[model samples]
Target: MADDLLLGIDVGTTNIKALVFTTGGALAASASVATPTERPHPGWAEHDPHTLWQAVVAVIRRALASIDDLRRVRGLAVASVGEAGVLVGAGGEPLTPIIAWYDQRSAPYAQRWKTHDDPLETFRATGMLAAPIFGIFKLQWLRDYEPEGYAAATTWLHVADYIAFRLCGARTTDYSLASRSMLFDLRARRWSESLIDRAGLRGDLLPELVVSGTRIGAVTPEAAAETGLAPGTVVGAGGHDHVCGALAANVRRAGDCLDSMGTAEAVFLPLDDIPLDERLFIANVSSWTHVTFGAHVARDRYYVMDGLFSSGAAVEWMRRLAAPGASFDEAAAEVETLAASAPPGSMGVLFLPHLAAGERGAFVGLTTSSGRAALARAVYEGLAFEWRHMLDTIEGMLGVRARTIRAIGGGTRLPVWLGIKAHVLGRPIQVLDMDESVALGAALLGGIAAGVYHSEDEAVNALQIRERTVAPDVALHALYERIYREAFLRLAPTLAPVHTALNDLEMI
Candidate 1:
C-alpha cells in the first residue's frame, strides 16, 4: 500500500498546471507550464488541441519528476477551462484548433440566435443564456464559417472532455462542464435534441455525460509513458475551472459564494433555488451533482454567477501602462503602495475598467491631474465597484444580506486589493490559502472516485479551510460607498453608447 497521492491537471487560459495532493489535502508538489493563445484574426482566439495536451503532459511529467515516489499516485483527475471547444475526427485526431471561451469569433452566431428570438427559451431549458462564452456557439460558428472543418469533425469536445478522451480514451464529460454548453438540458442533465437542432448543432457530436466523481477510464499506456504516472491510473471526470474552484473554496451549498480573481474576476453564488429578482439574470456557472448525495439540485437550485469579466484584465492593463518594466509581483507591489497613497475615490477619477470588449466594468474618466497612482487606484476601485454592483443585484434577488464572502485565486495575493474588495462589498472577505483551488478541487473529485472520501461535504470538511479574514475598515468602507455610487452614476449611461461605438470601430 504505497502512500497514495491524487494528481490533478488543469488546462487553463494561459497556463497548464498539475498538482499532486495527499488524501488529507496537503499539496505534495506542483508544476506549471505556460500555454499561449493565438489570435489569427480579430475577435478570434485559438490553441492547437495538440499543444494543450502536450502542455498538460509536460506539467504532469514535471510534477511527477519532482516527487520521489512514483507508485504512490492513486488516481488522476482533470479540470479545464470550459467553453473552449475542440473538433475531433472519428479516430480522435484533431480536426480544428480549439476555439476558446475567451474567443469572440462566435459572437455573430450567438447574435443570430438572439435575432431569431430563441435565446430565452433556450435559457429556460438549459439554465444558460447562449453566448460566445459557450462551446456550442463556437461549434455553430465552425459549422457556418468553417464548413470544411465542420465536415471533417466527428466529435465536438469541450477542452476538458477532449483532454480526458485523449488521455483515457473516454469521451465523457462531467456534469459541471456539460452544463456550460447551452445545448444541455439542466433538468434532464443531457444534451437537448431540440436545442441542438435549433442551434444547427449535430447532436451526435456530444459525449456521454457523467457525474463528477465517476471514473471515466484508466490512463492509456501512451499517456502514462508521456506523463510518467503509474499505468492504468483511474481518470475521474472533474469539472469546469470555476466550479472546481468553488468546491476548493468550500462553496458547495446555498448562501456560500466564491470570488475567483484570475484573468477575469467573478462572484459565483450557489442557490438552492433560482434567485427571485428581476434585475439579476441567471446563467449556469457550472453544474454538478447537487450538494446532497442521490439528490439533484432542482432547476431552481442552480448556480447563479455574475462577473466583472474584465476586472483582473483591467488590473493587468493598468500595471503594464504604469510599471512597464516591472515583474508582475513587483508591479502588484508598486500598485499596492501607490494605491494606498491615493484616496478612496482616486480623486474623482472614475475608471469603467472595460479594457476588454464584450464585457462590462469600463473605466470612464481620466485627466492630466490623474497620475499613474490615481489610474492604478482607479483601476482597483473600478473592479471593486464592479463587484459591488453585481453583489448588490445578487442581494436584491436573494432578498438577504450575505455575511462573509469567500475569496480565492492569485489576485488574493495582494492584501491591498482584498481590503478594497472588503470595503467596497461591505462584507468580510475570507481568503483561502490555496491559490490553485481549481486544481485542488479537481483533485478532490479524484479523492471521491478513489473512495478516500464518502461524500462531498465530508471531502470538503477534511480538506478546505479558510486561512485569513479581512474586516473592512469603517471609514474606508464609508468613503468607498460614496465613490462607488458616483462612479456608477457617471458610468451607467455611457455603457450602451460606448459599447455600440466599440462594436462599430471593430467592424470598421
Candidate 2:
C-alpha cells in the first residue's frame, strides 16, 4: 500500500530522530530530540541508556503525531552510531551507560593491544583497526575499571540492537554492527571464539547475530503503548549509520563509495575481498562486512571505511568564531561565497582541522592579509585534502582509479565544499537528494523485513532517486594536487609533538 508507512529511527551521537516513509519512498513525517552526551571527567563520554531510550520513545511519538493517520505506519527499524553499545543485565535492563566512541577512557588498552592475540590476526578476524574507538576496548575498560558492572552484565548490545530489543524484546545484532565490536569474525560470519577468549569475554554474553533485513520480531505491547506504535507492527535489525546511509545513497557495488560529510566526514568503499593491506593501518583505514552477511553491495564484495573526526564540527566552529551573528543558513551561504572569492590553497595559508581531543586547529602561514573568508576556504580545503589522502590510500590498495564519489549529509549542501572535494579527489562527487537517508535506510530495511521490498537493492531502487554530480575542474584539480603534496600533507606529523606537549601541560 502506498499509504503504508515505514518508520526509521536514527539514534545519532547528537540527536535521536524518527522518520516515516511511504512504501513508495516518500518521507511523510519526522521529529527529532537532542541527545545530550555527558563528559564527567576528561576524555570520557557517556550516555545513560534508559534516558536515551526514553528520548527515542518521545521522538517516535512526536513523529507519529505529525500525520493524522498513524495507522498507515507499518514496520520500524533503528540505526545508531557504531561502537557505542548498551550493556544490559541478565534481565535485559541496562547495567552500564553506553560509552561514546570518541571517549578516550579506553586509550590505555592500546599500549597492550596485542596482549591476548596477534594484532594482524585480530584485524583479519574483526577487520577493525586496533583502536579505542571500537567496542571491544570499551568492554575491557568496563571489566578493568568497573568490575562490579562487568560482573552483573549479561548481554552487550549495540546501540541499535538495544533499542530494537526494547521495541520487540529481541536481543539481536546485525553483521554490520557486530563487526564494530572487534569480536565478530568477518569471514566466518559468526563471533570469533578465539578472539572472544583472547579478550576474556564469554560468547554467551554477546547478542545473537543475525543477517540484516531479517524481521527479528514486532514492537511489543509495552513498546507500542509508550511510543504509540501499533502492537505487532514489524521491526528488523539495522546496521551502522554510514552503512545504512550508503543503502539510500545507492552504494552497492565494488567501485561504489560514499563520503558521509557529517559531524565527522567518513569515506566508504565497497570491497570484493577482505583487504589484507597493511598500508590500510598506515593510512588509519579499516574494513568490515557489509550489512549483508557476505560482501556488501554485491554477494562477493565487502566494505572499508576511514574518517576525519572533525568535519562539520570544524565548520560549526568557524561559524561561531567568524560569523557569530549569522544564522546557520546565512553563515553557510557566506562561506560558500567566500570560498569562491578566495582562491584555492586559501591564498598560501593552510588550515589543519584537528579540532577535537584537546588538539588545536592550526593555520600556518597566516599573514596580515588573512581574513575570515581565507580561513573558511582553508578549512574546506584542509578537510578535502584529508579526504584525498584517505582515497589515495584506498586507490593504492585497489590498484585502480575511482570514477565518482557519492556524498551525503549537510556538507553536501555547500557547493563550494563539494567542488573542493571533487577537485581534490579528481573525480565527480554525486550527492543524493534523500533528506533523511539514514533514517530512510533504516525504514527501508524495515520495509524489506515486512515484505514491502524484496531485497536491499530493490529497497534502494524504490526511492527512484537521481543525484546531482559535481564535476571536478581540471585546472583546480591540478592546483589542489600540487598544494596537497607540497604543504597540507606534512602538517600533521610536524605538529604531533606540539599536540603531545599541549596535552602534557593541560593547555589545549
Candidate 3:
C-alpha cells in the first residue's frame, strides 16, 4: 500500500494542514501549521491569501519529509473553508485580503439584497438565502467598497479553487463549494448569471464548477519543486471542510448524520432531494452538494446543514473572559460541578446564549441571583436546546426522520457535552474515530481521482473508521424533556423583549 499514497490539504480559519494517507486507508504522516488572519477593525476578519498559499506549500513539504517513499504519493486535494473571492495576476495573485465567512461588515449590504423584489424567485434560482456570510454579498460589498480593486481583479476564486490554481495553474471549484457562494444555482448546477448581475459582479469572475473527486490537473513542476512532491501528481477538486468532515464520519445515506461542534454546532445530514420548503428560511436550512455524486437526478442528493452559528464559540468566550487562566476542560469541569450544585433551571435565571450576535433559543426570569455557575450551565444547556430545536425544525422541513446523529470535532472529545447533546435531541450519538476528518475526506477524494479506488462508495468504505457510540440516557432524557418544554414555552417567547432591549443596548 506504500505504492499508493495520497495527500490532502485543509486550509481552515486558524490553521493549514496536510495529511498523507496510505492507500490502505490509514493516515501515514501529517503536518500542521498556523495560518495568520488580521482583525483590522471590529467585526472584520481578513487573511492574506499569499500567507495561506505559502502555508500549504510548507505543510506539504513537511509531510513529504516524513514519508520515506515519496514516489508513492500520486494524488492531492485541497479542502478549505469556502468563501468566494478574487485571485489575480498571471499566477492568480489575490488583489485584496480574503474575507472570511465570519466577517459581518457586509451584513447590512446582504440585508438589502434579501429584501429586493422577487426574493423567493431569486432564492429558488440560487438555492441559497442571501446572507453576509454567503460571499455574494461580500462580492457586492467589494464592488461597493473597493471599486478600484474590483476593476483590477483578474480571476475570482473560492479558497479551495485558489489553492488549486496555485498547485495546478488552473481555476475551478467543486459544486459543494460553489453552492456556498450563493452565486451557483444548486438546482441548475451552474453559476447564476442573473444573481451575479444583481450582485453587480461579472459572471465570468466565477470559476468553473466541477464535482468533487474529479482531477482538476496534475501538480505543476514548479508547485512540486516548492512542495517537495513528485511532479504530475493528480489534484482533485475538494468540497467544503464541513462536507468533507461528514464524509469522513461515514455519512452516506439520509439517516447518517453528524453533529459537528466546532466554534459553532452544526447538524449535517444527506437528503435525497432538494428540500423545497418555505420553512427552510425560518429554520435556516442550507444545502450543499454531496462530496461525491452531486448531480441532480430529477432529485439531488444534498447535505442539509442546520446550526446554532454559535455554540462552542460562546463557551470559548466565557472561558476567556471569566476564567482567564482556566483551560476549556477546567472550565467545563467547573461548569459541571457548579451545575450539579445549582437547581435544574439555573435557579430561575435564564440565559439566552446570544452572546455574540444571533439568538436561537429562549429565556425566562432574569435575576441577579444567577451567578457565574448558573450562567455557565445555561450556556451549555442553551446550546444543547438550540440543537434540539434545529433538529425538529429540519425534520419538519424535510418531512423525513433522522434515525441517529454522529458527533464529530473537538466537541466529541467532551463526553459530557456529547451526552448533553444526545439527551437533549433524544437520539443516540456516534463519535468518529478520526481527528481531522475533513483532511482525510479530502485525501480520499484525491485518491479516487488518482484511480486508487474504483468508486466513491468503495473509497468511503475503505476510509471511514468508527471510534465509539454514545446512547441517550433515559433518565437524563426525561429531565431534559421537561426542561426543553419549559424553555420553549416560557423561555423563548419571553426572550423576544429582552433580545430587543439587548439589541438596543448594543452591549458588545
Instruction: Say which candidate scores most in lDDT.
Output: 2
The Cα local distance difference test for each model comes to 0.75, 0.80, 0.72
For 168-275, candidate 1 gives per-residue lDDT tens digits of: 898878767777777777766678899888777788888888888787888889888888977778888888887788877877677787789987777777766542
Question: In every candidate, how many clashes are there?
Answer: 13, 2, 2
List of clashing residue pairs for candidate 3: 88-93, 363-491
Candidate 2: stretches off by over 4 Å: 114-117, 277-301, 357-360
Local lDDT at 210 for model 3: 80
Quote each prediction's TM-score: 0.92, 0.94, 0.89
* Cα RMSD, model 1: 4.0
Cα lDDT tens digits, model 2, 1-508, are 6778999999986789999988767778899988868889977899998889899999999999877776677788898888898778878889888898788888777547856457667766777657777788899888888788788988889999999999999999888888788888888888889877887876777889887778999989999999999899999888788778887787877777788888877778877677554554434333211111223422334787777778888888877776679998887887787778897888798988877644566889899999888988998998898777777766765675566688888788888888888899888888887767889888988888888888876777778676898999999999998999988778887777887788778833
Model 1 segments more than 4 A misplaced: 275-301, 357-362, 464-466
> Which model is ahead, 2 or 3, in terms of lDDT?
2
Tens-digit lDDT track of model 3 for 1-508: 4478889898886678999987666888989997678889877888888887888888989888978877789888888876645546544668877888778788887778767745566656655566678778788888788787777776778888888888998788888887778777777788888888777787767777788888899988998889998888899888788777777677767877778777656777787667544555444423211111122110135767765556777767656655678886787676566555665556665555654423434445657787876766666667787777767666766677888777777667666567666777778877877777788888888887888877777777776475787888788788888878865435655666866787568745
Candidate 2 global TM-score: 0.94
Of the pair 2 and 3, which is ahead by TM-score?
2
Residue 466 in candidate 2 has what lDDT? 63
Candidate 2: clashing pairs of residues: 271-302, 295-301
Best by TM-score: 2
